[model samples]
Target: MALEGLRQRLTDLPQGRFGVAVSGGSDSMALLHVAAETLAPARLCAVTVDHRLRPEAADEAQMVARFAEGLGVSHDVLSWADGPFARETSGNLSERAREARYRLMADWARERGVVGVLLGHTADDVAETFVMRLGRRAGLKGLAAMAPVTHFHGVPFHRPALDERRAALRGHLSGAGLHWIEDPSNRDPRYDRTRARDALRHLSAAGLDPDDIAAAATHLRAAEIGLQHLLSDWATRHARTHRGANLIDAPALFDLPSDPALRVLGGALRHVTGVAHPPRAADLSRLLAALRSGDTRATLHGCLVTRDRTGIAVLREPAMAEASVPVPLGATWDDRWIVIGPGESGMSVKAVGAAGLSQLGNWREAGLPRAQAMSGPGVWRGETLIAAPELLPDGPFASKFARDDFPAWLASH
Candidate 1:
């Protein structure tokens, strides 16, 4: 029954090469086995991310590779040891690792032209996530937890096992005479997820089942979707984009229900700043309160929001401006703009600082604030400013800014 369900999900996905993220665990191994049987070997590839945080991570990746090889499926191991993962100094190691894992997998998928990457998140994982979010006093979106399909850095991330149970997947593996590795961290009480899992087991014994929790999450997800549709319409009517900044009708937004209003401002701030996560909820609430009193200026999530005669303008925080960095053809800058090089060998992309703004002969004629214009994408060749595409007329080098899809972005993060 589980295999049939898995086969149906795989068949429903878009017809193209698919990438499976395998960690040599029971759930992931079951997914890989089923995928190998359901799809042609040529249509599937697997990637194992070795975070290198533990000594056995390398061997576990090799084990997954051997299993994939036996199934006639090509596989690759992406090491995080050499990337920013190695140099991370953040206090939240788990969050950092999660971010790094997705980043590496997304890059691998892009290079191989895969349509989507599949994960092995299961029903138990969803329940634990809900409990964790509940403990944190999260909003509806956070409690809703994981989705079956999401996009990260333009690559589709699919979790086909969300409806399946961990034990069921392990049972399938056992029945097939396959063995899987167990990460020690899964039982470590030091981690919040581990504690949540432990608590969920006790709660299940006390009559509150994990399945019931998962069902509640499903309902919350539906409510979240309904709110997103309403917010989309609100944004269309009251939000305007100018020179990479966002101008939202302040009075109109303030008139909205607190939740939707907060979401609108948060979405605008995220879009203007090009950050994956929205600003902290508490900070946003405080900002909204301040805006209600009178004209206000505040900063959050790398963006500056100011209420003025025109409206509320959300701009990239000048202090957080991206430094000049070399950008090859088809490369993205600041996660918001894509640099289109004019077949040039030496080109770099950066925020149009005061110096670059001065080079724009008739800057004021463009009708953008100097700070806002300075935050626009600028292409440079050595010491010469090539173009500030957002401020200037179409020219040689073009920077294409990605449109903000708030609902999709929020879900993925």
Candidate 2:
């Protein structure tokens, strides 16, 4: 394999242990080979996620393990057989599997103290994604395709080979006498990506090749970055967080252009809901239309959005805050609240529902809205309310919002 492309990509990465996600495929195998050669084996770790959707998946994972071990890189295999979609026989399996794969990798990266994981996405993948999203009538963000680096489950994933070609990677592997598994799913027309790949061939014949499309997507990515900067500036001026809710100056937000307004509202919703992606564009457009027509309340993507004379407030849906976790000091509740407890056992972190709120005689004095207060994290020992931090400033257990700063989170995302 040529070392120049991989070396150039590695130059910007921080000095730390890096994890490589290999799926026993050509692209990933090539990445593993190039990265292991470019970086010290001590600084390289390899992981494979077995989705268990195919009978050959386990063997494929073993193939990657053997290859990684041969290269003197530590390897581990993660399984998604027991994940949320283990029994899911319907819906978008591809999307769910991709999510599960990344979720597993993110946990592995954190546990292994790796800075980030490297992926095998290449120019072909980017072009295919652009074509797929174009068919969906996707806007700027979607057409921009896959980013070279992106965060999944809070772990940075680097696609260093985004500018490389799939065939080129395969040829390199072949030249090095390395072998890779070919997934049968790649040929399955039932998948959208397979169809997109077929469409790319026809498009290529018409002189619109993968490289051209990939380059166009790169330009779109630059444009999106510029827009994100504008959104960040606007968010800094108009968005505020109060009791885990994002409050925006409605007049100022609506005064902006439609695209900027949508970006601001979408960012606010994502921040409040802890959802990685923004709400569907159609849903957001409808919500914006309603808000412009004097609607005071709306809901989308597990958030409760309300507009008042002062501004718009995007908050977690009260019912969606039903997630709970044991009071293990550092345990997370609702994927956002970090529990800092009194080191007591037999306690669990739960939403401060109406029952817990009623127990706080001075709840109203806290000045938080009733809905927001109800969704706040509270330590409970069964029916007994142990600590309601949002209501009682001096509670025994104090909790912190993981994404406390809206503007900062907006800028980063």
Off by over 4 Å in 2: 81-91, 324-327
Clashing pairs in 2: none
Per-residue error for 17 in candidate 2, Å, reads: 1.3
| Clash number by candidate, in order | 0, 0
Which window of 10 residues has the lowest lDDT sum in candidate 2? 323-332
- Write the residue-wise lDDT of candidate 2 on 1-413 in tens digits: 37477678976678999999999989999998988878888899999998877777888888889999999999999999655456467656676677778777886897898999999999999999999999999889889867778877567899999989999899989999998998888999987899999999999999999999999999999988888877887878888888788998877887999988888888888877666778789899899887777747877988888887777888887788864334455655675677685666777888888889888888888887788888888888889888888778686678788774788777666
- lDDT of every model, 2 decimals: 0.81, 0.83
- The TM-score that candidate 1 achieves is 0.91
TM-score of each: 0.91, 0.91
- List model 1 lDDT by residue over 197-291, tens digit each: 99998999999999899989988988887777777776767877766788889889889999888888888887766555677899999999988
